[model samples]
Target: MTDATDMAAVRVDAPGTSATARLLAEAARAVDAPDLVLAVSRGGVRTVHTGGSAAPGPVPRELLTYELGSASKPYAGLLLARLVAQGRVRYEDRAADLLAPGLPVHPAVRRITLRHLLTHTSGLPGLPADFYPQAVPRWSTGPYGGYPADRVVRAFLRARPRRRPGTRWRYSNFAVSVLGHTLAAATGTPWEVLLHQQVLAPLGLDATRVRPGPDGTDAVGRRRDGTPVPALDTGGFTAAGAVRATPLDLLTFLEAHVGGPEPRDPALNAALTEVTRPLLRRGLRHAHTHTLTWFQHPSPYGRVLFHAGATLGQQAFLGFRPDSGLAVAATATRRVHRGDTFVATAYGLLTETP
Candidate 1:
């Protein structure tokens, strides 16, 4: 059932912040979800819409939970900022110091800071050490199976970074995984609990979950060819890409970043601001940059920040326009491959929201 608040949103116009329902329908057809859920909001009012091959209306949120892949990074980033706001950790704190002394790591790796990891400038490899050789066997389904926490720690301790820390920008799943484990180490709290206490709980995203293994409730993903792709099992990289969420929860996440919705908490609001604040820039053109988590881009509507993620057979997009309080969250139950326009449509929706 549509909530009363969302039902009333039909009469409320936030101005300059929505594409007609037709565009949403078109986007749904292009992505071809079993059920595609979208939530768009501005000026505190929000509307939730669904498009897909499946029969629409109000499918229960439980069956629509989609794996959020790298899109989960923003939550990790938010957790880092929230911890900093709570005085539990600092951005400048070295990851080595947080994880442990004597990681058998090189001097440069030891010098890596939380900010470097958060912004993907830590110079660590994008995946865990020796990922392919082990993952190749399972690549078609779920590739992140063998690297458990112990193995992950062992790999980071033994492997070396190609570039010095903080010298350049390279997206590193390794660095963020280490950061997540490091946070767990530093706070004396488990990764799941800390994330829940810091980010998810405050924003009222009860349907959002951090999963390390399979979930029976979430929608099963499929490839373009219709082969089922198993959900990822991030044994050690729980912080890197283990998030799953219903469209409603994901929409609330975007709304929180826009400072919309109710049941807000003051510290979380501050941390939200900190996460979106541009920390540094990358790319030769300088047009593409990054904040703590999202990619920052210049758009005609204003500056826009977004992050898109793909599991083996699903694509997720989350973005918002802070200046206008326009936010969007979308999910497709198919993998993102070359020429896929799922992300582009979502970006277009953000900039062209009427």
Candidate 2:
């Protein structure tokens, strides 16, 4: 198994095979994810990052530190599916059954099942209103700075249903975070341990770990104003969003989902496919469509399995065409404006083949 230090030296050698490489390289320069971008293919991998930054220098392909943000949901969904396959839990199991007793106060919430939570059909809002700060941080840094799990659970208990369970689609971090807690309770293991054993270790993804940087090791990037923003730990929300992985490790995981010929547990693979499948069409009121964990956007290329993440000033994007077996993963230090240049570049790569 390779350690983070060894992985940091890994780089892409297949630049010529990817027709999108030059364009992606240009996009990486445009956004400030350390001016770094990685494009991976079956034959090889290529990395491009702008120079002249901190002492650690440019972001290395092997320095395993990336905040996956909501990208962790797909992994969480896989773990739940594994429990289902083991007969330890069922998709139809209600939230009340999985959660600590008497926690949910809403009558309608009792009807929410594991599947509903995984698919974001639990009718729960994105984040509890009480947790919302009236003012944005002067500088966008670790938005969920002090919010902890206990506070999250307290706010959730007081939450009323936005729509009946399974009636309409609404994204809820509270729901997924609760799902992680529930899984931990059912299996009697830390959520991170479960992920490492079931997902990372199985695929030989040694660099992928739940903690921000294994033993305080991390990659550095600058904020928009040219201030160095060290990677911030997400605390207990690791299951909901705190996963740090290198582009190669991420590509390895995506390859498994896209049917790359790696020895993966059959049950886990099936669960991955099931989760990525479109569960329901959200009402028009919501701005976008969603799959179990993936955000769906119609492109001329085909349906794309994609998720974008933001933490403090850092932003990341992962997208792949499962049918075409092509994937692109990009991260930036400065928050790329939503629907900005980075996204456009990612889509351009997804649609164009080598």
Candidate 3:
């Protein structure tokens, strides 16, 4: 694990004056989030906040690892961009060209490009309704319990399009999950290993790993009730939202986006542009516009790039202003309402000066 003490030593300003911290502190308290960590780089800031379990006093930072939810989409976008940068793939290539021959996708679906998947314009739903089984516990160690990869592919093959590709924006976990498998086929490597090799290893993110704990590695928080939920078996959707990491490690990632050193392949810089660029306007109501993976909002400080993630009991947000080299990440155990509270808390943290 990276030294938390060393990360704390790095000078980062809070989002706002004392007021920013106070606002965030209020928000944190309101949501019952007890443990919060924030890191700012250049002109941006990132944070992780966790609500305490009723049984325990307060959740320890080291013990809290929540599902990133759709936040994992950005990493998937990065992986695809990396392939494009390496000449292994192209953005315009059809999905059928990359996957095996047996996929039963609609003819229009086959024409869907990698860009559509990254942009959430592929017209796939959040998850196939049939995949949801009442037998599965509401809050498992792994969010997608028992839904293996083969099942996911089968779901995709049988899926009927709600809208033609690129005509509209609809968030879809199934689409990105398919993208992960497509990358696996194109690269001839498991998506998990490829992500570590291409993104985490190069960045020196030692604490970030797929599937929380395997061979005695220390994992994050247990069940909300403190029942010590076993490590989640991600089954096949690991690439979608199964990776785990500490707040400080995530801060390091945000730092790299705002002019930090290229920890992975230098070629990754080219890929960053494709992944971060704002491609479409999501109808979702927010102060900012949505990009391929990141969200953009016009702050007094400048344009801010941000994204949020949520599962059963975990909530996370990453916000940054590239022009000012400022970034902020915030994670919480309880899901907070999406609006001024979340945006204000994130922006206030980003505006803080060390």
lDDT, model 1, position 172: 78
The whole-model lDDT of each prediction reads 0.77, 0.65, 0.64
Per-candidate clash tally: 0, 7, 23
Stretches > 4 Å off in candidate 2? 1-11, 14-20, 42-62, 102-104, 133-139, 143-145, 214-216, 283-289
Off by over 4 Å in 3: 1-31, 43-66, 102-104, 134-143, 214-233, 284-288, 335-344, 347-354
Worst-scoring 10-residue span by lDDT in model 3: 44-53
What TM-score would candidate 1 get against the native? 0.90
How many angstroms is residue 117 displaced in model 2 relative to the true structure, after the best TM-score fit? 1.8
Per-residue lDDT tens digits of candidate 1, residues 78-154?
99999998899999998887776755678877888988887888888898658889889988876787788767766
Q: Please give the ranking of all candidate structures by TM-score, highest first, separated by commas.
A: 1, 2, 3
lDDT winner between 2 and 3, please give it: 2
Candidate 2 local lDDT, 14-111, one digit each (tens): 43544454555555555434545555543223343332233344445345466667777777877787678778889898866666675647887778
lDDT of 1 at 104: 63
TM-score for each candidate, following the candidate numbering: 0.90, 0.84, 0.81
C-alpha displacement of 287 in model 2, angstroms? Answer: 10
Candidate 3 residue-wise lDDT, 180-259, digit = tens: 88788888999989998888776667777776654434333333453444554556666677766666666777776777
Candidate 2 TM-score versus the reference:
0.84
The prediction achieving the highest TM-score against the true structure is 1
What residue pairs clash in candidate 1, if any at all?
none
